[model samples]
Target: MKLFSCPSCDQVVFFENVVCERCNHALGYEPASNAMLALEPTGTAFTSVGRGGDGRQWRYCTNYDHGVCNWVVPGDGAEPFCVACRHNLVVPNLADAANVALWQKMEIAKRRLFYTLLQLNLPLVTRAEDAEGLGFEFLSNDPTSGQHVMTGHDDGLIVIALAEADDAEREKRRTAMGEPYRTLLGHFRHEIGHWYWDRLVRDGGHLDACRAVFGDDTLDYNAALQAHYANGPRPGWQGEYVSTYAGAHPWEDFAETWAHYFHITDTLDTGRAWGFVVNPRVDREDVLTAMINFNVFAPTTTIANISDAWLALAAALNALNRSMGAADPYPFVLSETVLRKLGFIHDLVHGRVN
Candidate 1:
């Protein structure tokens, strides 16, 4: 995430900020330009003071009325929702105030996920364009209807359980599942990985290469999952997989690893935006000396280069969290084998098959 500033006062503004605190300029994210613009309402539409000086009027996404989104749709565009919200097919009933609150939280995470996806310049097709293009459904467990919603991806549609938005509920599940970290954004990244696997690996004619790196995805998924839960993760799983859940099947391994790649690169981008640099004055190991001055999302960034900066900064972040009597910000370790898998994903995302 690049650092944002209010065009009115140049005050530092975070991604989720809707109003510039200093100048009180209303703000909205311009999805086309990937910029947070200070808005000037002109008639029924908004004229961005930042990049769209072309007098291209824009309107906030319909969801913005509910305070759920800050993204804007071009005034001339026919879509009611922004690029991110357009993917949502079914949302929890907002009649219940609780559901509204949960949906708000989910939208925040979802927008952040979209920001990263847009930053990576990944293909984001709507279901209207492709039958298997990306879409979302946020549902809740309804006992009366005997409807239970489990968070998972099918085809190109990703369903998220509304309860997952509750931090306490998510933490309970994390503890029960013996997981190190879990978040709404993490869930988005993981499920979207499944969608991309369909688009990029399975259909993109790189299944053979992906199989070599992630193991044969043709293996029986249900059986693999059953054995995984029954026996737990294999011993020394850390060396090969990003998480114990990743070992369930080759598809999962790819998804989990893909999620981590996003985690590392996006977090590294945030660090860079904050002007963070790691040049330890002590020991100064060669691997820890890489500076984070370059654009991490650039296709030229090698996986080895990413790992170098990621490892050093993640260590510092973990230590900072410990100093504050909190859990490590990043609890996973990347072994050489895992790094190789991440390299494959990096290459794949950049459209390099060889």
Candidate 2:
């Protein structure tokens, strides 16, 4: 995500900031302009108070009252939620304070996912608009069944387990599953990848091309998953898949690779926003050198540029983590085959492929 600034004081802000620390102004993100606005309350609504302010009134999404969202909707608009929050089919029970806190964490990650989707100009339709439109449900374990909510996607609805919000619980599951990296953001990206596959590939006439790259998704999904758990990831998966889980099935490969595509472009965008450049003085071969000067989300941006910059930035990030004794922030390595899968996603999103 790009770094935002408090429009009133030009103080550097962040994606989730609700108030400008420097200017002491209330902040809200306007999705249409992809901008964070500093606001002054005008009755029940707010008026923009900085450069490019048209004095137009804005109102925070209804979810803002719960301290979960900071996106704004036009004051005169009929919609009660912003573009990102409108797709919510269900949310955790806010009556419980513990649930409220967990849901807040979930919303933060979900909004970041929407930021990249919007930047890519991908299609987003609420379930109200279409039966198979993208939607979300934050659920907890069933009280009766005593079964945990599986974090997965069904058709267009994505279910996120509230248990995943707890750092300890998530880390435990990550360890048990032998995943090097797993987080709420990763869950959102991976699950949404399935929805996009339905919309862009299955429905958008790219099935044949996608199959050639991701393999035939028509294979039995349940059987494949059963085999994956029983027998483990396919041998030599590292040479062809982004993650071991990706080798379970063709659909999974697409989703895992799709999430990585988001990971690469979004992280690269952040690197570009901070004016990051990788030029190691000690290295004679310039293979590690990269300048994140181009917009990673642009239609014109090539997968090669993104992959090169990401490799350089990922190295710096991993090194920085090691300096503090933290695990590598990025743990996956992209092979030539994985890069080709990512390229297909890039082209699909940019309308370069049918």
Most TM-score-accurate candidate? 2
Worst 10 residues of 2 by lDDT: 280-289
Which 10-residue window in model 1 sums to the lowest lDDT? 282-291
User: Cα lDDT of all candidates, in order?
Assistant: 0.89, 0.94
- How do the residues 50-162 of candidate 2 rate in per-residue lDDT, one tens digit apiece? 98788999999999999999999999999999999999988998889999999999999999999999999999999999999999999999889898799999999999999
Question: Which residue ranges in model 1 land beyond 4 Å of their true spot?
Answer: 50-52
Model 1 local distance difference test score: 0.89
Residue-pair clashes per prediction, in order, are 0, 0
Q: Which stretches of candidate 2 lie over 4 Å from their true place?
A: none
